[model samples]
Target: MLRVLIIAQCALLSGVLVAEVSAADPGSRPNVLLIVVDDLNDWVGCLPAHFRANGYETAGAGKIFHHYQNHPSSWDDFWPSKNLQFPPTHVPAKEYQPAFDRKPRPRNWYMDFNWGPLDKVVEETGDWMSMKFVSQKLQEKRDPSADSGQAKPFFLACGIYRPHVPWFVPRKFFDMFPPDRIQLPPSKADDQPVAAGPTQLREVDAR
Candidate 1:
């Protein structure tokens, strides 16, 4: 089942990264290679049901799941989930931030339809580099079961950090798609229907 989440920013940033690498043994247990990328919307390719599914069991993403029991390792040991814990609890950014509160810069709306990297780019190394390293090694990296003599399945997770803030991308990649070749997204010149009546009509008389 496909699911979409629309934040306060209208359209969902719906990019996901999921790839599977299994061994030859028909009965071999799967070893998960989890490379979890963050902040990317749904434009990434071959993204399985990740935002919803938990772990290497099968991907599907909607929210964070840290239930270790669900994804046991080949050793039958429970894995621990880690988070970037700076504070004990969540606090308003304006209140807690020391130097750059919310952020030093404003969020990119991508309204200009601009191509290529920003003047001051965000992702310097680029996700492609990271993905290439992980994608190539999944098969070779799988652990062998001591008794079984077969390669175990594994989850290879990689994190793609940008396309979020600065919307930085390398110029060579942008050149692949020329403006003339690109097709515009469908649109309606007129206003579309809305389920919620305008606040004006619902609350006050409009002269």
Candidate 2:
């Protein structure tokens, strides 16, 4: 089943990200797949609690919720576990080395601020691992061993952590669009200002 969420300037209340899912098939309990993304100009909500409360089995991986406000009760299981919140970075935290050529800048979260080709394979990254886990779950069949003798409809939320920051993508993707062939979008000084408020309050390196 396919559903689209249209969200605009909506606040997250009671630690739940709420949004309307349109075009759902009537009278059928279809499995839900909630794919949340980070650093995108759009926003969304948490529907796992509601689905679970209504007899759905909830599971999630990656950035389903903000790293700090994860709701463990909302999910039957979550990736990176509830304690870890986020998956391990492509580069281990302890072994990370910052750019020495540029002057040190003060910031709240400074790691992974630089971008370039990663020396590692895509399979070695946390995002790839999370995706693999989700794929495995999707392919799983209902277990007859359950007490109910049947499996409940699943509400799976997969959070993709890319196109956000630290664009250490594999060289192949970057190679597809050569820098010389890239064209800049037209802009004007008189254009209306972009969305700004609490969302844009933080410092992010979107290079």
TM-score of 1: 0.27
- Per-residue lDDT of 59-130 in model 1, one digit per residue for the tens? 111112211112222111111223320111112233222222233322232211212332322233444444
lDDT by residue for model 2 (1-207), tens: 012221221123123232343213322423222222221113333467667778998887886654344566677888878555577766433233333223334442344354555557788777888898788778774434443766788988787877666566776777788879999788664563432221233323322
The clash count for each model shown is 31, 3
lDDT of 1 at 91: 21
TM-score of each: 0.27, 0.57
- Indicate the residue-level lDDT of 180 in model 2: 90
RMSD of 2: 11.0
